[model samples]
Target: MVLYGLKNCDTCRKALKLLPEAQFQDVRADGVPGDVLKSAYEVFGAQLLNTRSTTWRGLSDAERALDPLDLLAAHPTVMKRPLVDHDGQLYLGWNSDVQAALLG
Candidate 1:
């Protein structure tokens, strides 16, 4: 399993604590792999973009208007938190549903 998220994200930290076996890939330090990002985007659609994030808020209207993939590539942190990859299936967020799916 691979966890793509920021080290400073509390939700990510909580997920890492519970999923100790998952390899943590800090998205800020090393951006999500292109293939993985694309796959996640395909599955999650606009949900993959964290429009509420500080990065998103800081973006100019023009920048925000860019394709979500472009925004994510330029600002990795703008992607939603704790995007977990398990056996090639993508799971977004560390919510109860995800916890049950991953940890059960």
Candidate 2:
């Protein structure tokens, strides 16, 4: 399993605590792979972008108008946290549903 998120994020830390065997990737440092990003976007649609993030808030209206993938590529922090890839399945965020799926 590979989890992509910010190293400093609290939610990411929590997920990491439970999934010690999972490989963690700090999105701020190493960007998500193109294929993973594309697949995530397809599965999650616009939900892949964290509109409530500080990074999203900091962007200008013009910048916000860019494609969701472009925005994510330009600002990794704006993407949702703890994007987990287990086998070939993609799970976004550390919500209960995701926990159930991964913790199984």
Count of backbone clashes, every candidate in sequence: 0, 0
RMSD value for candidate 1: 0.5
Q: Tell me model 2's lDDT, rounded to 2 decimals.
A: 0.94
- Tens digits of per-residue lDDT, candidate 2, 1-104, equal 99999999999999999999999999999999989999999999988999899999999999999988888888989999989999999999999999998998
Per-residue lDDT of 11-65 in model 1, one digit per residue for the tens? 9999999999999999999999999999999999999999899888999999999
| TM per prediction | 0.98, 0.98
The regions of model 1 sitting more than 4 angstroms off are none
Residue runs of model 2 more than 4 Å from their true location after superposition? none
The TM-score obtained by model 1 is 0.98
**lDDT scores in order:** 0.94, 0.94
- The stretch of ten residues in a row with the least summed lDDT in candidate 1 is 64-73
Q: List the residue pairs that clash in candidate 1.
A: none
lDDT of 1: 0.94
